[model samples]
Target: MKYKWKPVLAAMLASFCLFSSPLTALATDNTVSTIEDEMVHNTEGAAEAGSAETQTGESETPVQADEEPGWPSGPSIVAESGIVMEVSTGTILYSKNMHAQYYPASITKIMTALLAMENCELDEQVTVPHEAVYMEDKGSHIALDEGEVLSVEDCLYGMMLASANDAAYALAIHIGGTIEKFAEMMNERARELGCEDSNFVNPHGLPDERHVSSAYDMALITREALKHEIFRTVSKTVYYEIQPTDKQPDLIPMSNHHKMICSGKYHYDGVFAGKTGYTVVAKNTLVTCAARNDMELICVTMKTEGRQVYVDTATLFDFCFDNFKKVDIGSSGTEGEEIEVSVKEGDSPEKTEKIPFRISEDGYVVLPSQAEFSDLKPLLLLNADRGPEVTGAVLEYLLGTRTVGQAVIALPESMIVKPEPETVQNETESEPEQEKEKEGKGFRWWYIPLGILGALAAAGAGFLIVRRQIWKYRWRKNRKRRRSGRH
Candidate 1:
């Protein structure tokens, strides 16, 4: 009975294994499939995320390239309008909304000083007007009073160094007769200096909706002002001692308001001249000039908040000095050898002569430090009356579409060869004689023989006629004799 029960139990266990094995295997396969689906979904999501990141990374490639070695990514500046210009070449190195107009504040005195240097003698006396001294209630001034006398030079120092509104007004009134007239003169001079978007409503740059200038226009005005020796001298003055005026008995010591020029904290090694301007409306406007290794740069920053103006200007100067260099495109004393041009309709159409042209002046071009001469393209623009003797600008060197420098196309005074006038021989006189000679030569040798033969034939015909006449006569004579004999 025990052996029968053991066999029955073994048979029951075998049946249970047979029935559950397939179900268990199916459940395990379902679990693996669900996990694979989850893994596939996660992999697809990760790939999609990676693809988006790659697209974003590609857009930022240029900025990354600018940060690479030897490549300069310009410093971030907070100024609303700024420009860095090369003084010698007038090449703008960096710009941010440079043409947008903003209030000039005290930087207007750069033009004021320039006009004073141009129109009046430095030692000439300027009588301060009451309106000029009292024009601005809340602005920088040197405490000038009515009928106070100061030289043009002293007023320029006062205006530029101290950002004195009164000094600027007095100088303007002296030069232009009235403030409105001076404003007109300022606009005219600004146009002459290539400032297109500048308007001066007041000489002191007091806040007015009409009185505004762009960073680019102010840079142009500053560049022109720097050309004047007196302006340069007065602008760089850190401290100037003004002699006691009739209105102010105490000696008024004026110091430049520009930190880069006066204070040591923001001062730079090569900073030579600068002007500072500020108002509640026009915040922290600054114009500065610096020189390093003979390369001069002018930096103008406008609408900057707080002390960032000086930092922005100094950063611009560093960028220019680091990345750019002045290349001498042409030298003044070195004249280009004469270029030969063929004269088409002159005395000798086949003749070619040389035109000796010199470079107009020593022309410099500001370019990247790594730039080469091969990057420059020379375009020769011949004059409408272009000839060996015509003198003017012959060719211009260009970097892309910009004209970098020019060469004077002129005939040398000593080497100018006037073309000889061609003699006009009379065609009527010479042509007929040539035609007669040609006609004589055109007669053939056979024509001469034919003419002789025709003459001989005519003579032979005459002889025949004479013989016939004789024969008739003889025959008549014979007939008469015969008749007589018959009778």
Candidate 2:
């Protein structure tokens, strides 16, 4: 009877598993939310072509002895176009269709914010115009009204943290008088930053058939943007609030739209700043900046499918950080440590200063972990990258024909013997200011102790005088008692 019942129990157990399996699978899948839950993971474990590829998602490739110079292996990502660039040296750590143009949705605000930061001060007041107030109600905004007054800083927070399209327009109008003029400034600035694959038509990145930018160009723009202290502050902010404007009566609160920064599900360590964007036409685009292992890297991925964009960014960051290291190639700052150069400024025969030509302090090269600092080839040039401060030399560091890094041979700000000030005011006005500074700090090292001793001496003299007076008063009282003869 027991043997006969065993098969029956087994059949029931199998039935239970069959019914519950779908429920279990559904629960596990729900952890991935919103766009990611809808994303088709077709490109998982595959690299979109034309990249020096590695397996996606935390998979690492060891540096090979025979790998090409200055190129490290990067991960397979679903982004249609992407690149990983070291922020300091501007070295291309990873590449995949990097220069290919695509519509760059709201990531366009990076340029808008950059222009605002460069052109305007934080507390500068900006007014909301009619065009900005009347944009499509469907686009992101804080419901600002026409003639609303807010500072440039408030507009920046709204644009960056809330992805507000209206703020971008207002900022555009404030800086360039109109969006059209502002976009021209954007393109001009893009060109100045060496962004060859971009054209800016709008500040808010609303879909226009003519609007387009490339991943490489976006990366370059971001790299330049990060140089400003305020830009860094805006990008990394998780939450912000704007005081009610003239049009709005309530305080407005905002959370960063960049999921990698605010959402714990996709949070990555060392990812300090990022911008996220999407439109039906542009798909998902992302730019993130992270610092780890002494390397600040910018990762730009455009036309990605969904949450995989975040995954792709993290994977690339890990790959670069795990495989490469920054090798310092700066001047040792010691005698015989630098080559001597003759610098004759202004055709003045007064002095042809023999400046010790040393590599700039900012000179550092990113190389594969297997490579050594000794492997870099140094070449010296007479060109002054910085026109005025450069004592007339630029040291170019190369790794097998690739220009890995360049350093300006600069005159130190505190040259034990500095060159004369360039301007007449600087030469004349600086002397008195310097003298005043010297006078302010003049050998007052003894003043503190001397004042303390004087205070103590005064207190001691006061104490002795008081004691003498008290003793005299007591003797007088005793003498008066003796004269009375009351005892």
Q: Which candidate ranks first by lDDT, i.e. highest?
A: 2
Q: Write the per-residue lDDT of candidate 1 for residues 1-487, one digit (tens) a residue.
A: 4467888999999999999999999986654332210111123354345334323344223111112232345666667788887786777777777888999877888888878878899899999888876663536777788899999988988888777788888888899999889999999999999998899987777778899999999989999888888877887888899998667798989877777876576788888887887765786689999899778889998876555676678777887798877776554333566544433333333345565646654566666788664566555554434454454444455566555544444446643444323323565568889999999899688998899999999999999999999999999999999999999
Off by over 4 Å in 2: 1-70, 331-357, 384-390, 410-487
TM-scores, one per candidate? 0.64, 0.66
RMSD of each: 31.3, 21.6
Summed backbone clashes in each candidate are 0, 0
Once fitted onto the true fold, the runs of candidate 1 whose alpha carbons sit more than 4 angstroms away are: 1-73, 136-138, 331-360, 380-390, 403-487
Please give the distance, in angstroms, between residue 487's alpha carbon in candidate 1 and its true position after superposition: 99
- Residue-level lDDT of model 2, residues 374-433, one tens digit each, is 676655554333444444355566677666666665554433333345666678988999
> So what's the TM-score on candidate 2?
0.66
lDDT of 2 at 181: 92
